[model samples]
Target: MKFSACLAALFGAVFVFLPAAAAPVDAGHARVELISERDAALPGETVYAALKMDLDDGWHVYWLNAGDAGLPPQVIAQPSSDIKAGAIGDIVWPLPHLLPVVEGEIMDYGYNHQVVFPFPITIPEDAMGPVTLDVVADYLICEDTCVPEQARVKLKLETDQAEANIREGELIGKWIAKSHVPFPGEARVLKKDLNWSLSLRLDGGFGKVRSIRFFPFGHDILHPAAQPVELGRHGATVSLSAADMTDVSKPLDGVVVIEQEDGARTGYEISAVEGPPLPDTSGLGPVGGVGIQVAAWKLILLAILGGLILNLMPCVLPVLSMKAFGMVSAVSSGHAGEVRRHGIWYTAGVLVSFGVLAAIIVALRAATGPITLGFQLQNAPVVAILALVMFAVGLWLMGMFELGTSLQNLGSGLADRDGDAGAFFTGVLAAVVGSPCVGPFLGAALGAVMGHSAPVVFTFFLAMGFGLALPFLVLSFVPNLYKLLPRPGKWMDTLKQFFAFPMFLTAAWLAKVLGDLAGSGAVAWTAAGAVAIAFAAWLWQREARLPRILAAVTLALTLFGVTERAMAPAPAIGASSAYAAKYEAEPWSASQVQSLIAEGRPIFIDFTASWCATCQVNKATTLKSKAVHDFFAANDVAFLVADFTRKDPAIAAELARHQRAGVPMYLWYPAGSDEPQVLPEILNQGLVTSLPVNP
Candidate 1:
C-alpha cells in the first residue's frame, strides 16, 4: 500500500510539469530576456553577456552541476571579428535543496524564481565603431517532467571612447565572484582498510559550513553513496572511507564544496596529507594487523584473563572471602558435607549470574541492531546513568546499610532457608560489583567485542565468564583447599567485619565518581541517601515491621531524588568558543611568531587535556618536573595552554586537518616554517630544550 501511494504521488508530480512547458514567455507568466554590454575597446577590456529567465511560480532551472538528473543551461555567444572570449567560468549556482522525486531517488536542484546566466567577453584594441553580438542558448526546464527550451538573444551598441558605470560593473563583478569556487585549506589523511580518512578544516564563518560533499574526480576510488561520518561541532571532523586506501601515499587532492544550511555553497580543491602512523596496539589484538581471525583469538584470551582478574578486585574480593569463611566455618563445625554443598551452590550461582548477563547483552544487542563500538558508548544519558549506578554501588560497599539479600528475607523465610540461592545471588552480586573496574586486560577485549560481529563478541564474553568462574569453581571441588583454610572461631567474626572496610572504601570512590558525573548536588544527595539508608537499616534490625516500612519510604524518596538529579539537563562544564575571537591567521603567522620571539615574549605551548590518559601521564611526570618548571621560568617562553578535554569543535577541526583526532597534539611556533611543527605524542625535557630559541 505504501509503494502504491508513493507511485501515485510520483505520477501526480509528473502531471504538474506538463502545463509549465507550454506557458507563454511574458512578464507575468514566463519570459526570456537578455542583458549585455557591447563596446569596441582594447583586447583586455571586459564585456558582459547575460541571459535572464522569468519563470512562472512553480517552474525552475538547473545549476552548473545539475546533480544526478538535470540539464545545465548552455550558452553560445556570437562574438564580432575583433572580440575574443576567455575561458568560460562555471555558472554561479544559487542555493540548492535535495528534492525527493521518486521513492528512492533525490535530485539536488533549485526552483521558483527569475535566474540569470552571465559570461565575460574581452574586446581587442583598435576595434570597429559598431558591434553587434548574438547569443543562442538552450535550457532544459522542468517542473515534474522536463522540456527543452531554446532562445536567441542579440544586442548592438557603439563605442568609440571609454565609458564606465559603477553600478553595472559592481553588479557583474558580484555575480562573477559568486560563481568562482573557494579554495580548501589544510587537510590530513589516515588510511583504513576500506577507506582513506580525509579530515578538513573549514575557514570563515562558523555556521557558514553547513554540509560538505567530496567529488573524487577519479573513478572507483570511492563508492557512490558512501556517507561521510558527521561529527557535529563548529569545527566538525568528518571521516571519508574510500573503497581502498592503498593507492594513496601522501595527500590526495580533490574538490570539496561546502553548502551552508542557509543555502550558500562554496567550493574548494582539498588535499589530504598522510597523517602519523596509528599508535601501538600490540596487546589489543594479534601481533600483526587487526584482521578477523586475530581479533577473535585476542577477544577470547583477554576475556579469560579479565575474568580471572575480577576475583581480585575490591568489589568481588569481599564476596569471595565471605564464601571461603562460610566454608571454613562449616568444616570447623565438622560439617564436611555442608562445606561441599556450599561450594557446589556457589559455583552454580556464579555461572547463573554470568548466563543472565550474557542474555541481557545479547538481547539488547539484537534489539538495537549491530552493537558497534561507537554505538555502545554514544548515548550520553546511558553513560551518565552507568556512572551514577557505579558510584552508588561503591558507596553501599563503604559501610552503608547492607543491601542485596536483606530484602530476600522478607518475601517468605524461604530466602533464609535456601543456602544455594544465597550462593547464587552472591555470585551475581560479585559480577555487578566488578563492573566498574574494567581492568587493563578487559579494556582491549571489550573494545574488540564492540568492533566485531555478534558471534565473535558473544564467544569472547563467554570465554571471559568461564575464566572468571574458574577459580571459584575449582575451589568448590577441591576439598583439600577447604580443609586448608583456618578453623572458624572468634577470629572469624573479626575477619568478616574487617573485610567490610574495603566495601566502604569502594563506596567512597563511587561517591567521588558520582560527583564527577552529576556534580556537587549529586554527591550531596548520595551522602543524604547513605544517611537515610543507615537509619532505615537500624530501624529494620530493631523493630522488623517499622524498619521495613521506613526502608520502603526512604528508598522511594532517595530514588526519586536521584532520578530527578539524573534526569536534569547536564550543566556546561567547559568554556565555549563563541565568546573567543575567531582564530585569525594573525597571531600565529610566521612573521608574528618571529617578531614575538625577538621581543622576548616567553612562549609556553601547552598541549594539555581533560581526558587524555597520555597527557595525564605526562602532566604527572615530565611536565610537572621542577627542572622543566625552572627552565620555563628562566627562558620566559609565553605560556599558552590548549585544553582539549571535552567536545571542543574548534580544537577538533584543527586536529582533524592535522590528521589527528586524539589529544596531546602539540605545536611550537618558534617563529618560522610558515606552519607550526607538530610535536611527538610522547614528551620529554630534551625535546623542549631543542625547540628554536632566539638566544
Candidate 2:
C-alpha cells in the first residue's frame, strides 16, 4: 500500500508537469504588464520591474499558502550575463475570502480582477551596460475548482545611476512581516503509560494564547482528530494519548500552530525531547502485574464458570421456585409421579436450549467464517434488537403479564406436553443474558475459541452450554433434592412476588444497554414499555378485556418508538476533514493500487471497526508510532487506511479478497504490485519500515 501510494504521488507529480493548453488570460478581468524602469541598473544600484494587474469587480489574489488551498503566484526570473539578481520576495496578498469545499476544510486565494508581483534587481559591483531578463509567472486561479495559470513576461534593463522608488520595497517588507509566523519555545516530552505529555513555554503571556493546533509531520504517529488535553497556566502542558502510539522510542517532531482568540497566529517547530524511561512498576504490590493478570484471567474464567453458574442465577431461581410451587400443587393433587416426569422434562428443555444456541452460533460462524478476521454479531441493529428482547423478557418476568401461559406454550409442544421445554428455553435465555457479563476464565476461553478452527470453536461453545445447563440437569435427575424442599404454602406466593425485583433489575439493565445502542430515545421507549407492561399485567389479572386492549395498544406504541429510535442516524466517529472539496472514496482495487503506485503517491490504509475493541486499541497504539510515521514521510508513501469499522460493502469485499471476515487486517501495496502484502494483527515499527517502496 505504501509503495502504491508513492507511485500514485509520483504519477500525480509527473502529470502536473505534462504539457497542456495554457489557461487563457481572462480578457474580462484585469491584465498585468511587466516592464523594467531602466534597461539596466548601475553596479550596486537597485533596478525595478513593474508588475501591474488589471482588475474587475470583486477580484483578488493572495500570498503563499493562500490561507488554505489556493496557490500563490510564482515569478521565476532568468537573467543574462553582467547582471545579478537579488532576493526575489513574495508578492503582497490582499485580504481573501474563505471558500468552502465539499469534502474537507480548505481556504482558497485569488482575485477576480488582477494583481502585481514586483521584484527588485541589484546590479553587480562590476561595470555593466545593458542587461536583459526574462520572467515567467505560474499561478492558480479559482472560482470553484482551481485552474493553473502561467504567463511569460520579458523585459530588458540598462545601467541607470538613479534608483527606483523604495515605496514598493516598504510594502513588500510589510507583507513579509505579516506573512511570518512567530516561533514558540521548545517543549519536553513526558512519557506515561499510554500517552505522551508535552510541557512547553510560550514566548508571550498565557492571555495571548487562544487555541492551539498541533500538526505532526508524521501522519500516523498520532490521531489527527484527537483533541489535546491542555493544562494552561504559566505554560501549557498537553497530554496526547498513545493508544495509537506506534513507535515509543522515536522522537516527536511537529509544528504547534497556535491561533489566538484575537486571530493572531504563532507557530513552534517542536522536537519532543525524551523524558526518563518510565519506571517498571510491574511488581510494586498486589495491585501490580500479578493482580492485573489475575484479574483478567479471573474475568475470563468467570465467564466460562458463569455459563455453568447461570442455572443458579436469580432469573432462573424464580422459574425454579414457580416450578416447585407447581410440583407441590401436583403432589397435593395426588400426581407425585408427575414430579419425576416434570424434572426430566425440564432437563430436556435445558439441553435442547443449549443445543439450539450452539447450532445458531455454529451456523453464524459457518456463514461468516473466522471471527478473528472481523466477524461481529452485534452490529447496530442486532444490538438494538437484543437489548429490546432482553428488556421485554425482563418485563415479562416482573409480572407485567401472566407470562406463564406464553412461556409454557413456547416450548410445550416438544416431545410431550411436559413443562420441561420451558425449562430448556429458560436455560437458553440464561446463557443469552450471561453474554454481557463475561465471567472469569470465560474471556480467555472465548478469546481462544474466537481464533480457533470451527470444530474447536464449536467444542468450546458446547462445553460452555453444558456448564450452564449442568445445575438444572443434575437437579432434574435428583428426586431427593425435591423431597428436601419445604411443603407448598402461602410462603411460596410471597417468594414469587419477591422474585419480581430481580426481573425489574434485569429490565433496568437491558434498558441501559438499549440506550447505549440506540440513544436516549431508546431509554425513553423502554421506560414507557415497562409502564405499559405493568398496566397490561394488571389488566390481564383483572380479566378486563377493554383495559387489556388499551395496554396492548400502549405496548405497540412503545415498540414502535423503540424501532424508530433504533433506525435513527448515529453520530460520525471523528472530526470532519479539512479540505476544499471531499472526493468520493473510490473502491480500492488491484488496478487502482497499481495506478497509484505508478503515480508515486503515498497511501494510508485504515482497517477499522464499529464494534471491534482491538481495532480501536491499535488505532490508539502501534499504528500511531513515530517510527512508522517517519518511514511514511521519508518514503512519501500515500497514506490510505481502509476503514472496516462499519458495514461497508467495499471493505467487506476487500476483507473477502484477503480471506478475512473481520477487521484489524492490513495490506500494503508497493509501487507496481498488483497485490497488497498482508500486515499482522499486531503492528510494529519494523513491519512499517519493511514495507517495499519504489524510487
Q: Tens digit of lDDT per residue, candidate 1, span 567-594?
A: 4544454332211112111222122333
**What residue runs in model 2 are displaced by over 4 Å at the alpha carbon?**
1-306, 309-356, 359-418, 451-456, 542-557, 570-695
Candidate 1 positional error at 668, Å: 16
What RMSD does each model have against the real structure? 19.5, 23.6
Error of model 1, residue 230, in angstroms: 11
Task: Name the top lDDT candidate.
Answer: 1
Question: Lowest summed lDDT over 10 consecutive residues: which window, candidate 1?
Answer: 280-289
